[model samples]
Target: MGEPNEVAFRLTRRHSSVPRARAMLHAALGDWSVGQDALDESELVLSELVTNALRVRVPGDRQVGVRILLLPDERLVRLEVSDAGAGKPQIQHPCEDETGGRGLMLVEALAHRWGVEERVGGIGKTVWAELKAQFVVPAPAPPVEVPAAMVRPGQCVRVWGCWRTALGVRGDLDADGALHVVIELDEGPPLRVRSREPLTVREAGTPAAHEAAEPTPG
Candidate 1:
């Protein structure tokens, strides 16, 4: 199970602080092993929030607070930005000629959800957004089972890219150890193959020609 991870910092309200906050957020997401798609969206959301904070009516010495949280098990990531200014942000319908009213609009389209709330014990507010992370699951391995009776002389078995007649059962072991069988292929010298169920001989006169013909289980 994965646990929650978080990163937080303060930035002085300045135009240069936008890139600095974005870099820190990028580093934190990388350390938390976030996916590329989520990381890109996160960095964009961070930039918008920071820019809004810096553009608000805050004093020269006021600082912006940035925070990021990752919930791996939940496949969720949250970003928050707090400012000393009391102004609230809202989505605007900017005309085609407009160049600067689309920040919150971009945030709404990129994030799964976003909103603003009053800052605790302060005069300002915090803007937050949540994004869904893309987590990949690995495929399961195939199953192979061989019966003990199948390991014996005169048995036709397919192994090592060729069919071979089992000379004899050198020895067999439990599940933890491999079963040793001496097989003589039609072309090459006699070779010994170890496996739990490499032998393809299910019945006499019926040859299991291909070793890799079996379908892997899901």
Candidate 2:
């Protein structure tokens, strides 16, 4: 959407920090408009990193640090988890009989690329991963204008502050013979507008509106 942004937080070194880390990562990536699949993968990667960070032999008072960055232009998302532990994390290949030591394996499979680096203060290490981001672009604005009377089913109209498909339209004359137009939308309730009121509408098959055209009223 706009420029890239970063979010950082610290979590207590405990088993509870795993889900909390995932929640914060989800919130940050969701705000960046990341796709569902990417969000899922990113959360899994973060969970593994945080879990490994928690297992590090650090002091009780030392906390785990997490950082998330989204680069819209590059279509990339980066995750980092740091701990004040002594040793570096290495990917392990455990036998089938072993039920553990698979965290890094999952990270390697899910992330685009991953590695470790020494913490800035040199007291600990930071595990980082980068994942491809799926960003959905908004549809373009409507170009063609259609009059309310000419509006037909399967067309798109901007009413109630949203773009909705036109389900049906009809005009009725009141006791005074003043014409009132009723337009039905695919979502929400119908709309009733006076014949003279302005309406925002677009023909079918436009970029902003991709509804299949229906037969016009006889």
Candidate 3:
């Protein structure tokens, strides 16, 4: 059986933090099998939530934070942002050129459901959103057979990709963003990488793209 379907990521304000969040999500959830529409929606939500935290943070204390949770069995994913500022965020339908508004409204229009609440007994507040989907798991692939010589270095085949968790890609990203990739390709400890943002794989390389796998799982 697979491990628990719940995972959490906590972070402070940093330039690379947002992309790390996205990459971590993609890794933990097994390639984000999300379709074109869903993928676009998820990315937009992440952007809005993170950007809000950045813009409205308390300057003196500088303790702004973000958390992402995925509840796969329940068919929902949640994004939450918490900051020292106690001001309640409103989802205003602002005019086209309102100096600084429209974040919450965009979230409301996109999320299946979203709301704001006090952070338990805390001083800050958490603006959050939840999205649900009729997500389906892919059928397991049949085995492959090939010559040992064809496999090369640094290759990530599906069988291998499934079990590995990566924090980030080494060369793909610039200084602004990083990734926190987690995979379950095997029963190994989840890898927590801090990587530069690389171009996301529209499709992971082909079977022949990288090194071939050993006959058995790593």
Candidate 4:
């Protein structure tokens, strides 16, 4: 169960659960801003899975469980339906005149991968399908920080009466265009401090001296 990104619920064995499951999928993927074509495909796969689960010969008292999970890395959407049925599902090729038995076929055609797995610690099975999807909103990139050359990574700087080795540098420009360098220090635990004032810095084994502030480009 992925917090804030997954939806899981149990539904009674009824036809109405199918639409409710589709609505849940739409709400989840819609918040992620997935592409329409991908959303449509996900909805179709979900519908088939839920419908098939409802048809299984589970005890009348047992309910079907539905889970929708979205993976941002591969832009993948997954659907799972669980029921206490006694058999695995197999895809079938029906004659053109047959009006039914094409649910698994449609799922195999639309989903990148589909399979059945034993329900964990339960007397049932879970059928899952994964589809490659496209996100309308792209994932955010990591922040890139500009480096300040005056204080190199290998230099040592005095902070609070102790000399800490500078591990890295990051720069930021103020609203008034003033330059500030954020120095990452290797104390007991890693620490960071902004250099907005004059400070003493030097090589690892050398005497400390004041170095003129250098500007970091935006």
Best by TM-score: 2
Those runs of model 4 whose alpha carbons end farther than 4 Å from true positions after fitting are 1-4, 138-218
The residue pairs in collision within model 4 are none
Per-model CA lDDT versus the true structure: 0.75, 0.84, 0.56, 0.79
Spell out the clash pairs found in candidate 2: none
Candidate closer to the true structure by lDDT (higher is better), 2 or 3:
2
lDDT of 1 by residue, 1-218 (tens): 67789888999977899999889988887777777899899889889999989899867888999989998887888999999887689899999998988999999999999999999998799999999987544333332335434556765555554445666555545477756554554455665555443444533354233234542211
lDDT of 2: 0.84
Top candidate (lDDT): 2
Model 4 lDDT tens row, 1-218: 33336789999998899999999889989988889999999999999999999999878889999998887776688889999998999998999999999999999999999999999999899999999989795443322222343677877666666677888877767778777777778865443334445455666655333333333222
In order, what is each prediction's RMSD in angstroms? 11.7, 8.3, 16.3, 11.5
Clashes of each: 0, 0, 18, 0
Predicted candidate 2 versus true structure: per-residue lDDT over 1-218, tens digit per residue: 76879999999988999999999988898888899999999999999999998888878999999999997777999999999987778899999999999999999999999999999966898999999999765565554445567777887777755578889999978889889778888888787767656566666556744433432321
In model 1, where is the ten-residue run with the lowest total lDDT? Answer: 209-218
Cα deviation in Å at residue 16, candidate 1? 1.5
